[model samples]
Target: MPRGTDHRPRYEQVAAELREQILTGDLAPGAQLPSTAQLMARFDAANATIQRALKSLKDEGFLNSRVGKGVYVRNQPPLVIDTGAYLPPDGSFSYELIDVETLSPPADVAAALGLADGEEAVRRRRILLHDGQPLELSASYYPADIAANTALSKPGKIKGGAPKVLAGLGLPQRAFVDRVSARPPTREEVEMLDLPVRTPVIRQLRVVLSDDDRPVEASVLVKGAHLYELQFRRLVSDPEANDV
Candidate 1:
């Protein structure tokens, strides 16, 4: 293909096209890729450029090359996460406490919690691990008035989770809303999640409300885009479908 007006490097352009094929199942899992020489001709690139493109995909876990054979797409299935569940960690999951501090929240979080300017919130930062692997980075904030001296303000992992702690404090969570988006990962997130180069991340901002629509908790959950996909279920005939 001609470079034309596309500004990306030759190898990157080739890799991007291959990546799309793999993602869309045009190149199915376990299916061998075309020969290196064939790819060179197809992309109108040099041998080294084709090799670089293949290397990039392999580095990203999209392809694997055999010793004497050739490259094949890996059988990697994205993890599907139920967006409605708010369950505590069980035997297979664990939490690593990152920090617990009282600080002014980000603008969005401050607005979610209805905090006045300069008003501080207690933040509990931690990594949720599955099978001892980092699955998500979470930072949960609670109004200082409600969480100041509670376990939510501590560095140790709570027994059940923040929900139980909040319930005990008479602020049981009745409802919650999630706003999710996808974007490039932050430097800290890339290191923490051990993400591959060029990998994006999914950001979920959740607000848990109690009685009288009082916001009890606001949380930021980040996950590697390549590793997980959000799943939401709904009834087709439900009147609240529009709300969803």
Candidate 2:
């Protein structure tokens, strides 16, 4: 609204203003946003501008619009997943490794771990909990040769944490490559996780690699949206001063 200022896209400006209000908690979750006509009058902007701004917010998952109902703030909070950390540092969460079996690797997983076609791999399933709350459902696979030395070849050998069991077998914990995505849960996952129909779950596929850069394990973790917060931190470097 300042005079003599360069102009940007009107919709972007409107969206930014609304985004600030939402983020500042001025507009709480599930709170209804101003109607398009109301916002137009308030901002003295065209209907197209307001609609575009709202559409952008909706696409970003900050707002939801229902037919015949006005736009409202999204009920679900933003997901914060931590991809940088490993599980069970000095005994954190309770992990139950249910079963392990030698099985043919699935096409997608086989490609991810760079396994040979029709190769036998150890498939281990686990159910992990955080303070009695079901936190994650996981399935992990390791190359047959790598797992053959360990007890994973036997069914139900690793009935707790795979990392702990592997460490006991002289294979220490290693680095991991993680891929993350969000989707609605399948019927089985929904029931297993005890999630509601509308709740969205996050899936992380992790490939655990040994010190030699050979992938030794592949894990798929399905986590509920509400139970965890992901955080990332970075150090800022000042160009003016070379000092840390």
Candidate 3:
């Protein structure tokens, strides 16, 4: 912890040490980090180096500075998302209904939902919360004809989720297709998610097909990639194992 002990820049050395501590869970989520004075003393580094080290972690999304509160480790444990599963996979999550409106679906969304050109769809937008922090943005598109006068079109939380709503309309989803990608977050997404600049997001485009193979629903989810992981359960055939 002496100044210039390592050939690397003092700030990088300090940042590297702190980064390891966070990755190793020595500093747990919401744990307040050491004060600048403490870090400077421990590292034998100047104020500028100590400040730069803290800023590095902040830009990496490992730490956040509160206006009144001191710097603390961000509660960014990866959320486990089951592909094609119902929203709020567990009870620990809180959700907010951002918007529900009839709008001209984006070109790709319209195609996924099997809507014609210029055709409108009911768009339902919701955001999921964990520990009172936003974790995901989900938007589902339903063909106007399919959603009219149903719970899907209503501007309120659906009692049984989208699947149940479709089931009520005699169009239960028999299968779903999901395609995932990642990209830099937009300005609006940065604000909505309270994410660090330059952070990338995971995008999952899902299409739900009815029993007759009709694409009844399509949804686009933008998730905090740094703070989430996707999990899937697969069943593989092993007929030989059945022989006894």
Write down the TM-score of every candidate. Answer: 0.84, 0.58, 0.71
**Candidate 1: which stretches are off by over 4 Å?**
1-6, 86-93, 238-244
The residue-by-residue lDDT of candidate 3 on 125-186, one tens digit each, is 99888778888888999999999999899898988688899998899989988989999998
Candidate that beats the other on lDDT, 1 or 3, i.e. the better one: 1
lDDT of 2 at 176: 75
Evaluate model 3: give its TM-score: 0.71
Which portions of model 2 show Cα errors greater than 4 Å?
Answer: 1-81, 86-92, 155-161, 164-174, 233-244
Ranking of all predicted structures according to lDDT, beginning with the best and ending with the worst: 1, 3, 2
Each candidate's lDDT (Cα)?
0.88, 0.75, 0.85
- Model 2 steric clash total: 3
What tens-digit string does per-residue lDDT give for candidate 2 at 50-109? 998888777656799888988998775544445675464434466676777888977767
Q: Which sections of candidate 3 miss by over 4 Å?
A: 1-54, 63-76, 238-244
Judge candidate 2 against the unseen true structure and give its global Cα lDDT, from 0 to 1: 0.75
For candidate 3, list the clashing residue pairs, or say none: none
